[model samples]
Target chain A: MTEKVSIKRKVKCALLNILMYISCAVICLMLAGIAGYIIYRGAGGVTVDLIVNKPSLLKGTIGILPNILNTLYIIIMTLAISLPLGVGSAIYLNEYAKNKRVVRLIELATETLSGIPSIIYGLVGMLLFVQLFKLETSLIAGSLTLAIMTLPTIIRTTQESLKTVPGGYREGSLALGAGKWYMIRTTVLPSCIDGVVTGCILSIGRIVGESAALLFTAGMANEVLGIFEFFKPKMSGSSLTVALYMYAKERGEFEIAFAIALILLALTFIINALSKLAAAKLKGKGSGR
Target chain B: MKRAANFLEKAMNVIFTFCGFIAIAFVVLVTVFLLVSGIPAIKEIGIFNFLFGRVWASTAQSPSYGILPFILTSVYGTVGAVLIGVPLGLLCAIFTAKMAPKGLGTVIRNAVDLLSGIPSVVYGLIGMILIVPFVREAFNLPDGANLFSAIIVLAVMILPTVISVSETAIRSVPREYEEASLALGATKTETVFKIIVPAAKSGILTGIVLGIGRSIGEAMAVMMVSGNVANMPSLFKSVRFLTTAVASEMSYSSGLQRQALFSVALVLFVFILIINLILNLVVKKDVK
Candidate 1:
């Protein structure tokens, strides 16, 4: 009887482990299925001219080059605004803030901002950047709106990364007569580079994926809107996700929509994979250094 | 020289201290902006009517700010998503944290990371093609898009966040608790449910709150699957949500109608903000 019970226990544990393995496999299969199908539908239209030329509603003439450029423009502009402000806010939250209540309030605010619906951010952008500031529906407005949307994520991630750095590093730098600001610049920031980079990459990924916020703030004109056209209303452009959404909503052009989706998915996957690679390399270097 | 350096240091501290308050200032300013734009519309609609009215017709002349219908629909959608998402997520978490083989855990984690990385819009597209069609055929419904469709797509979207958070929480529960339970003649299933789950309740709660926020604010995907009709709530029938209402109509709206849409956003903002604050407090207490 004792031997039988012991065997039964072993079998149960083994079955539990098996259950875990199966669930993992199933989840991966489902997610990968989405990526695979999008790529499958999109692969036939992968041509150089298709990638570089202007988008045409004609049967097979939908290239994403201009849309890609718009995505890049949005990303750069968003990072330009968000990085300085996010890092600065994180620095204050981690290093300079004294009152616990103040810190908590800031935390609350950031969390709340992160949770705000993207459409709300779009409305705010429409009201503030477009109507109030008279920036119009330009790339600048889109980027700035996205910058606000991404800011909470950046600040939270950066603060958490900064907090992970040992207090001893700060103490040692201070003891050496370095000013707190100097110490943060030289020691704290340098040590927290890996964490900060990961945060930035994640934020970039988010900006690239964002749509609803940009839909209103940045009008979905497929023109080659240059960065210098920020002051003009004519240079409004849309990011890849928004472009995909527009294409899909256009309805009749199923192939064009599918192709754009494929490209968008590919872009998303590549960016995410690159970020993962950067994170891994940075982690390795940090440990090795 | 030491005195001069001390003075510089003090000044630098003061500067950085002020910088910290800027973050607080950003929050306050944004809140003020929302309130400034939203208050008049709220007043016009009447606070009670806005909160409880069953219909949502926010035209320029006879604007009805009754968010009560959308609020109920949002709740139904979120609850449906949670019911599906939380269990699947918890099971996935259990598998990864306790069951998977050494390399399998890494594979599953990476898969989840990739899933989380997929934009919500893409998820919307996938749902439009796959789940909507499947549900339409299976239920023989008139419209493919409805609350049920929204819930399923959201369930999948929230799955990654839930799994990752719940996994972390469950993993953090000391192994000894499980070991003790097992040593006392308990099965693995019994131990996980009775010992492990209870211990990780706070972490699981945090994940639930995060999922709730994600679902509440979700626009792109839900906008696609939800029928985008502002009417009485039915699982099979089409409905509109606060996020959907804002996204669908913001383009043509002007003057008071636009302001009314902004007011809808403010309502969502308030709900999510309250949830976030409660979550942070719960986390802080749990940490303590």
Candidate 2:
């Protein structure tokens, strides 16, 4: 049965429809404006010399080579140390944990970890790494702080993929006289490579964008370091975001800041794309269609 | 040989169990560190005076250690952000979830992802360049970096989460419910707003709570555009959030000042913990 709509109802529906479209348009326009404006201003400032050179006081020049290396050093150090721990924890929770209560507790702790702010992570990193452990304000201290922050992300992703590994695979391997660890190594772990890759990409995104935590632990120095120097106790260097803050806020050099911002923006886009690819791959493998 | 294999298995089980507990250890370490460092400043200044006192002259002749201004600013900024962002985000979510064509929805979703991926400092930079000057000219104020600018920036910043979460929630609402509402002669828009939205209320609430957490914990962007003064919050007046208060003064601060910053952080942590607890309880209850 077709029912006649009241005039008031019609007007309200029209209004809501208009409001919804307008809201969507506004959001998209705002995003476009921000991205276009940043790229327009920042891209022109990005130069080869900016990428290859370090900031020099005597020459009145600025570069982000040191910042770039610092960022890479931190990411490599953090992922190297954290990947094993995070995946191990995920395996424990998904495959080995006996009691439900213990699983819940660990999950709760992970949730709490994820919810805590980065600035507090900064403070605790300062107290524990710099003060208690006597690592001082160095890149290693900063990267360890980031490792903790990204642990939940890694564990959650790995555990999710571990869950999707078919039980039949495990049983089949056991029937073939393979031990439990052997079964996992041969069948379960390899299936979740995309999950680990996604976790790594996500963590890299976080480590690249992080500033406050690094500001406290990784002191702001623009000197480029040799690879071996990264592990030295008192070595300090700023990541890209920290360098951006220093250039824009502290040094009042918007040109250099915007150039750095351009690099960061590009990095973010690449990271976002990589994560999407990894997630899509995982989903495809999980469905097994 | 069998005994050695048994020992290897047992050792690995112990190792994995220890790894599982590492997160708990980290949380405990963080909490204990904050408590050990944070308590001294509060102890130095009476709890009442520290929390509720209006003045915050940390570098004065006789420095005062009150954090009311910071607390108020953070609360007001978060509330303001939520009020402005939630409606727009909700409307956008509904549009994308139900109204938009497939290609358009994907584009909007990608845009939203890109928005979230941009760092907070970049947001602050954009706000400083654009919003700050606009506010100053529009209001004829000497300084535009104030609570209002921070709220505006925060509103934009939180939109990605609100849009994505609410869209997921709304999409998850059973299609049968909406079909039933439409079958009852209700308009499409009516079914969406009245039926789908109500069913997805808990998820929307969770998004809002998460937004509030983001706004409260935000320091770098807020510090840039908030004109970090110790003033009590007013819409157009300079203010300091609990976060910026710590970040702005942590460099070169000494004695009671440093301790007080820790105290402020502790208070902020308590606020975050409460928010987290509330989110967990509500989500759990709703699930049950």
Candidate 3:
């Protein structure tokens, strides 16, 4: 009887563990279901006109061309600015700086900045970028705000990647009579390229998902603009997030909003997949992936 | 040539150091800017009242700058989200790091990575369309958008952060600890809870705190389902948080009202800063 009870207990424990695993799987399934639902509602909405034409009430259709352009523009600008700043700070923290206190301070402050509410960042942007600097809701203003918003992520990830570089590599380069800058440029950075790239992709993912900071700085306009005229005061380009917001805010626009959400989910899934792919490749080549 | 290169390298080091200093300087500047602008409202509505008051109204004659109501709402939203999020996220993390087959673990981790990449606004739209209507019908309530709905949505949004961090923390635990537990005739569950979890407690706590910070800082999605009402939190009642309060009012607000909005931000900033500092200190101790 005791032997039977012990076997029963073993079976119960195994079942319990499997049940726990299923619960975890349910969360991921819900997210995937959300993505699937979006694609189902939006597949028919994808068209050339939808990607290029202006939004019109008469047609009962909303094209996301302008929002797409703005998102791309802001993303490019954010990367351009943050990449150098983030990588430079990481290098300085890991390779050059000897003092530990200053490094700790930077680490602490960056984490705090990362945690600061994006709405606060928006408020700060309103004060410094829009009012004080008189940028007046231009693309440049929006891009700068986003750059700052994602800065901590970029810096933290880069710093993590930099820290992963083995100390022997740096010492080996130095012992070969290479100068400090040369050692960092050739040995340290080359060895950590995978990490740096991971950081970049992560920051890009963040930029693509951001909304609060862009709301105030990147004025909401759904109209596309000429190359040079994109920064005009009256021009408004709604990003995927902002556009979905406008749709949800207005009554009788649920279908369009749902469709846009579906597209947004697709974009997110693709970016995330690409980031994972890149990380996998990089890690396979460098580490024991 | 070597001497010249050394001088050049030293100069480069100084320049890089100065640049890092600038990033730190920016943080200080941001804090001071928030506090300085918020001073006007702080003076007008005494610090004690502003922090303690429950009402958040702005009018010409008798402007009210109470943030207690909003703070309670923000706190509830965060706590509610975390309550639902942490366990599920921790479970997923443990499954991915220790329990799952290799192929299944990769799929689960990738799914989480994708979920994290989805924008908050997109999440809001999802909440508005699916969660909102379903909630309204199921509860037989007046409005679909309420604290309950907000909590559900926020939980979904924060899941990825918690899961990712916890997985990393759990994976960092030494395998020998688990091996020894198994060899001692402990069941897998016992081994995991008694050995693995205790060893990774600090990292797991860090993950939870980081999730808190993320949930607290989130504005866009919470703004959508929170119903934007500035009242005490009820499961079925609509409420506005500190973040949604600022976003909804900032566009049209002027004078003391605008400053009051900044004050709300200052309050939130200080709150999050304190949490981050504590988290960093805790993590620092563990790292050493």
lDDT of 1 by residue, A1-289 (tens): 3424577766876776566556666678898899888888777766787668777667546667778888888888888888777877888889988898989888777776777778878888888888888888888899888888888877876786787688999999999988887798899898777666777788888888889999888988886655576536546887888877887765544565667777767766787787888678666754664
In the order shown, the candidates' DockQ scores are: 0.54, 0.75, 0.64
Clashing pairs in 2: none
User: How large is the interface RMSD of candidate 1?
Assistant: 2.6
lDDT of 3 by residue, A257-281 (tens): 7777777777777777777776776
Predicted model with the maximum DockQ: 2
Candidate 1 lDDT by residue in tens digits, B1-288? 888877877876776566556556666766788889988888877888888888787763666667887888888989999998887788889878876677878888888888888888888888888888888999998788888999988888888889999999999999899999988878777688678989998998888889888898889888877878887678988889889888998888877777778788888888888877888887987988
iRMS per model, in Å, is 2.6, 1.0, 1.9
Evaluate all candidate structures by whole-model CA lDDT and list the values in order.
Answer: 0.81, 0.90, 0.80
* Pairs in steric clash, model 3: A221-A236, A221-A237
> For model 1 chain A, where is the 10-residue window of minimal lDDT?
A225-234
Superior by TM-score: candidate 2 or candidate 3: 2
| Cα lDDT of model 2 by residue, A143-172, tens digit | 889999999999999999998888988889
Q: For candidate 1, give the lDDT of residue B162.
A: 91
Candidate 3, superposed: residue stretches over 4 Å from native: A1-19, A56-61, A164-179, A230-236, B1-11, B59-61
Model 3 chain B is weakest, by summed lDDT over 10 consecutive residues, at: B56-65
RMSD of each: 3.2, 1.2, 2.9
User: Which docking class does model 1 fall in?
Assistant: medium
